[model samples]
Target: MARSQIQDVIRCQYCENEPAVFHCVPCGDELCPRCKVFHLKSKVPSGHNIVRLSERLHPANQIKMCEVHSSKAYEICCKVCQVPVCIMCIQEVHSEHAIGKIQDLYEKLKAETIEELTTIKTQLKSEISQRIKDYIMGEKGIKTSHEDIREKMKKQAQIFINDISAILAEALQESEKDERKYIVEIARHTAEAENFEQTLDQMIEKWETLTDSTHPVELILYRKQNPDIFKLLKLPNKLSIVMPSFSVGQINKSQNKHQFGKLITSKVNLIKSPVESSKHIQPTMSAKGNKSKKRVLERSVKTSQIKAEKRKLCYMACRDDRSAYISGDGPGIQLIDRSGTELDNISTDGEPIGLAVMLDRSLIYSEYDNKVIYKVALNKQKTEIISTEHNPGGLCCTKSGDILVCMGYRGTARVVRYNSTGRKIQEIQTDQNGERHFSDPFFICENVNKDICVSEWNFLKSKLVVLNKSGNLHFTYDGHVIASILKDRFQPSGVATDSLGHILIADRANNAVHLISQDGDFLSYILTENDGISRPYGISVDRHDNLWLVEQEKACVKVYRYL
Candidate 1:
């Protein structure tokens, strides 16, 4: 009784005579000790959360009252108006509207609020933290790039200085040699003049002494010795000094980056909202692992075949959805459409061994006759982009507009990367173990992950060599053991990668195209002899993810929708 009467300001809502002792959470009912006993006898709902008045979800006796009927508390909620109503209001204005228990709606909304808070505290926060870290890393990358560019500029200046010093030293040495020879000739002439003067003085003194004196023998002997001296002494031919001259050359004002080098700045946006990410994100479904499902090659259908005049098709580079560039043991590279109509022709010195296209639709190709890579612009103007030290076998243009060249001379093979303007950026030759990465890299491609994939063949066996963007050796894939028909004759000719990071290699000897996971695991033969593909040499993936294959035997390009 004393506990019930502890507080007088708050009385029992059920029995307003004593202070409230207990509260029902679901019903929102306040009860005193005396009223609580009667309320329990009235058969309250099961699992009703009842607690002390102090522990109530709301303040004691604070139930919401209907605004239309001030004397009544809200119990039912109108579904149509979404408002709480009392018994009198429900019977009058809310009679036509659907009604629900107000307590149920309150519980549902409460649960939803709690769930949203949890998500904000966990997942949303974590995502924000990760993005911040990525931003910081990007900042560091920019600074590193700045320092690297400065270092390159200093190195190039040093090279120019060294070259000029060598030329100047050679010129100075030649000039000094000419000066020494001129001085020797002048000294010899001076000595001859002095000797002639001395002989004249001696002859004059002898003639005077012979005129005054007595010995006829001395004068006679002197006349005999000096007989030709009186005739004439021809003066030495006049020596005119011929000085060395130097002409200064005019400085080249052309700011071509290929001559020296230039820094290229690219715009990068790192912030992405969920809605924006869906549109900007690449199709990375292939990167997702599917270990549970068995790998199988889906049947490929040739959607279109493009006939070409060149019998030996070597490489194919897709320019867009409508057209592609094809090269082989031919005089020029032909740009053709699906209907086999020639759109444009790029003349080459000889057969183009490597072919690729830039993002701007410019054609990049390397000819077998020269160790140089050339770019053909949209105006049909061709310019030398890169001059490699060795003959380039294949060329690939990366998403960032960099070119990867597969080059080798004699037994040495390597993959070199250059920026769009032809400055050497990277060279992937030996691995961490100092071992050669490829025997003969014939074709090259960049994967979705920026891994450099090279099709290497040494006539004995062919392999697919893959390296990470940092030029580290990722893996090397020889032909799968199950390919018994290509046991000893597996020759990887053309290599390409798709949006899924899956690598596809054309096996010219086996008449198949092998698809493998980016991790170097053999997936399946996407195109085989059964699919009417014979001597598939060059392969490429279009912007729409369609596979383009050049069939050497058919002298045609086949577009397949294997994906």
Candidate 2:
């Protein structure tokens, strides 16, 4: 047998040879059959509490004897000294100091410490991980931008090869030199960020292990030794990469090759970074001195509203650029800036139903009319990626670059998971009882917890269905009972999730947005017509947790800060 396969044996405290089968709680000693008799007759009293070794209480929960008065267990907590004391010690040293029950103080401190640790862990998992992803994605974007500049240069060079071949060589060389320099710097920064991400991962693992521990003394000692462990870690500054630009001059054969366009080097700009998120976060505690309740989603403040060019906003996908791709009745998807100015337009085969942006900055759209899914490259080239049997309505790109598509034919609806190459991996349609869970999954998005949330609607009824990563039904939501009073039938449209794993569903009929917990319990009404939201169709939560919602009636996308 392997060493790891061997079970540890607990020897008797007194005999050391025999395995301990009994435990004296008050004496904090374990004894075998022979030692138990001797232990009972010796120092330990016969009336002392004895239990089976298997029933031994965790040492952390065990009553600690006071150092000054060993006969009495700690009963009072001195607020001035922040220490536990016995009745005798309180009378001698803590008589004038404020005090409370030691057990009550311990519970409060533990709750506060655990809440802080949880906050740190949440930041490490969401913020740090997102920063790492951003770093990597920025590298890819830089490379893509570089390739695009080079491709343009190649085309320009092909036109005037005879006149400026030598100068073209120098320009190309200079571009390569700049690329090498910037790529190296980016690689170094990426490595540093990755190392920090790893450290945060280790810290999260340590927190998990510590929180799992049942020993109170160890937890208290750990907190004392590492006072800052519960606090949020300071992450590195956010750096923005500026894409290099090339100024192309008029192609004049008479002009010298030196007059050719020059390659401007890319720049790395440091932006004023916000820690974790925009909102100031503190350790949440319950007023009733209980475990912290689940975070509540409150009505958001409408910050900006941009009028989209499209008449009816079908879908909206956002990028790190603060720009969004809006698709509607037209056969083209328009990329619009934060101010709603159209920057570029990519033509599609048909009206794009589902639009999503991948980590590589590529765009994916599913066309219901063509029954096909297409990928638009960074160079504006569109190619058919997947041919679906059923019409594809909504789609999203996962963290792993996989695509989740919502497909429906007639009345049957299902969600299919596919790799970037269009290889089908899994399908979510039926439950354990073989009953269909969706009639028409119109919009789909994945939560930070990897739960796949889909808003399914048809003429009969509508609901929000969430499934685990493994395709098992996690939960389902049909509108809040009280909110249903405004409308008889639930009509769920677009769906999005925030870092906190709260699901935001667009209720088109009610002209509101419903916020629910990860487990499908309704938390609150995030937005309603009273907030000037009309026919909210599509919704998305950006990295900053700001909600980007599309109002069909208004023909605009609204940004809100709800956190």
Candidate 3:
């Protein structure tokens, strides 16, 4: 059976012909498809079992082995020749040249490829993470921008609504005034018409009685005699009647031509930074000397160098060793210490113009705007309104506890004395030398012997006039020096008396506080620097002989303590 199976199956390796016997006997296998002998046994070394071939080729028996030298298979590459070769080829042709094994070269190449791919993957992950973060941040920014836009739009809409509401309120008020005027006019005209009709009816009744059939001659005589009555009964010159028109559109158009939307669009503006409504205070620092030019406080006591705090819209009154009282135009009075720290606040509805402390420490203030005097308790619980006949401007409490008021501007500057129970007992300064004591008296202060000193505004001379308790002319302290310095007419606003009986006047127009002796001697300036006192309005002297000055324009209060 083995002989019959191999009968025609054996073919040449290079030629398609049956081979009688196998030609290449290295593997001892027949060729197929072509009768070319790929490998053959070495004839020179016949029994050595060595293989050779016409050309280098793969072995038919072993897939990975070389046919020429199967024992020395392809295990290395000739680096110089750049070709795969066996160990035998290295010894034959590439022995002296550099060579490397195929497995080692392949491992190195594989490691490099793996490293490069890993690096590329890491870079891609980092790039993707950054892109995601950027996208999220961009989205958040867009959201915030949209919210801001919406808030701005809402504010704009509210502004428009407020504008419209204000306009409507004004229109309603005008309409109310017009309606009242029209109604009153119509009522007056109707009453006049009724009176005219009644007069005509009375004349007709008299004429009808005279024209009765029983008295023809009497009627003629009566008509002839009473011709004036008929003339008087005639309707007086065409009743001047005025009928109101209901065409509010024409009136509204004539007054307010612009529509609500157009008006708002034209007038509405977005305010970026509104001005603060609080008062502003100026701080005081050391001034440089004239010759030495060194910054120093003028007074010996450092406590005299007072610093300003937050300013308040108020009028400054009395100042003692510990505190000063500030009466605001609003509804409260603030008590501040020498350090400008607020200690207490007392509430009063009346705007206090002038304040004076009684001997018992009770406070009395004149409400010039309300034309009344009020007594404020130290405990801030009791407040009594003392009704005065004159419109009081300035007030002063005497050593005897009698209150004196300066009635200004009414041409009747009279001082009325009030008891502790607020009773008017005496009238002082009524008429001096058969002429009025003052045209407009502003301020009053008492001396140690209860002698009163008053400041009077002389409109004729445009100067200040001083008067004593007996209505005797003391002196006229005009701003002569101040007028020379400012080159204009200077007016004095406030006056005070110190412990030494020195007079201090606030020369407001010159922005300085002037000091004078009781006998009208012009002393040295109390405050002369521009930065020290600005628009000084009120002046007061504490028990310590220090000067408390008020800057009305700047809403500030400054204290200057004497050494």
Candidate 4:
């Protein structure tokens, strides 16, 4: 037989009574349903495990109830010791004590506990509602993300099918043309053979009839006339049909196909979706174990740092905040509060060119002449030095606190990363194909997704270069028309991004600031005034998303608030 499950009984912490029904108020002692008793000194009456004598009694006013106690009325709690006592006990034990009514103390304690319980219940309800709202939002986000991916996949599949069908149709037409050409050539050759055979038969009959002296000469003349006839009749055993050899060059013209050189030069080649090499091809393993191991170490260090500083303040108002720092060519980085007050200014060894803030609240500023980054602390102290290869033009800090500096001159541009200790960790001066990155990288900023964006100025083109985290070229955007409309002097000088991932570029020559999307799409202009900005060199957006522009020639920093 199976054993029946037993239910556990709930009990008060202070009492050891079984099947506890009543809860104590003073020290939360539990009592059996029948043994429960309530002291008159207790605060809470109902909803408590301890039962009052009045609730168990039959008549409400049968016993002469005291006005002070309400149930068993008492004149005073105590005179000297402030302890609850009957009139007789108070006169003997606490005669000289200042007496107080028991009812007043009981009412005060009851009110306080009721207030506390009400506050606790309100807090619990609020927390539960907030959690429910968060769950709903999370579920909505997941659904939207799934729908977006599905739509993208559907469109991508349609494009692939269209491209494939076009390529296959062209191939089929070429194959059919080659087949028809071979068929026509075979028919023409057969007709030529029949004519040659008929001519030979007529010549043989004439030779059999004429056996005279003139017959030999006639035969010789006929043979000379048709000297090439026999040679033509004995057509080569296998005629060269000249069937069209599929060039395979058409495959190269298709954009979807990979480079032919890469395919042919590779050790392993694929034919009709299968390997068809005569020699056994061993798997080629990479020899970059050391490099990969270093990358893993760097990533681990970055992850640990992120975990340490887990305090995430998503919203910060920069208008009246002193934490926002800006750098210009004046002297050094100007430390200002949210109210735009200059708290303190730190001087650099060389002219200030760029500024970036690290995770530890330390400021990194690049000097133009010295080509070095000076680390400044909050105490107005210079700490470390970061050396760069070229004249540092721009500075930005990544999410992992890595510093990215833009350096370039003439026809070369690069974005290099450095660790917090002023050591160069990585450099990206060229594209994946080993081509020079850009003409001149004037400004650089890291996006939320870790991609580096550069404002480049070439002799003929002024554009922005977007590169992935691995330094691969992603896209380029040319502001040709906008530059021309602004009087052909739209050189991008300073670049910065907001929390929303919107990029703002200061067009120094054009005297305006252009706003661009995270994907290099031109959104609009932050500054539409023609002559409002004067040689803007440094640009920054504070925590409040207010635009700060450093006008180099004007020798003034302009602040614009978002309306």
Number of backbone collisions per candidate: 0, 1, 10, 12
Between candidates 2 and 4, which one is better according to TM-score? Answer: 2
Q: Cα RMSD (Å) per model?
A: 24.2, 42.6, 42.1, 22.8
Q: Give the poorly placed runs of model 3, Cα more than 4 Å off.
A: 1-314, 458-462, 482-486
Off by over 4 Å in 2: 1-298, 483-485
- Residue 384, model 4: lDDT of 54
Cα lDDT listed for each candidate: 0.81, 0.81, 0.63, 0.61
For model 3, the local distance difference test gives 0.63
lDDT of 3 at 6: 74
User: Cα lDDT for residue 465, model 1?
Assistant: 87
lDDT of 2 by residue, 1-563 (tens): 56654357788889789888999876789899998887777653224566789888776446678775788887568987789888777775568799886667888888877766776677646877887898899899999999999998888777667657788888999999999999999998898889989989998887777789657777788889999864757676677998887999775645544555677877778875564452323334333222133244455787778987677886888875367888876788988877777878998768899999988788899889899999987767888899998989999999889999999853568999999999999988888898887887889999878999999876776788899998889998988856543465678899998777789998888888888989988788878878888888888877767889888867888888887
Model 1: which ten-residue window has the lowest total lDDT? 276-285
Candidate 4, residues 1-563: lDDT per residue as tens digits?
A: 12332245654343454566554433345555444543323565222334432343333212333443455434346534545566555443356677786656656656766765565467645756886897788778777776876686677768878888998899999899878887898888788887767877886777676455465777778787877864565643447755466665544356544322112221323323123321122122243322232211111110000010111111111222234455543455456653445656666666566667776566777776777778876455786577777888777778787888888786546778887787888888877577987767867888767778888887777877888899888778766446443765557877777666777787767777777777878867657445355666666666545666666655555566532
TM-score winner: 1
Error of 1 at 204 (Å): 99
lDDT of 3 by residue, 1-563 (tens): 88887773645555656552433433444454233333433343322222234322444323244444677556567776656687667665467789886656667666766665565466645755886797788778777776876687677778867997998899888889998987897787788888998987887787778766546888778767876875465564455556555554443654443432222221223433222311111111122212122222353132432333425343566646667777644556777787778867776667777778777666778877778888876556556657876788777887678887887564667766677768876666654556666667777777654556666666554445566656566676766475435544556777777656667777776776666767777875667644466777767777766677777756777777642
Error of 2 at 158 (Å): 99
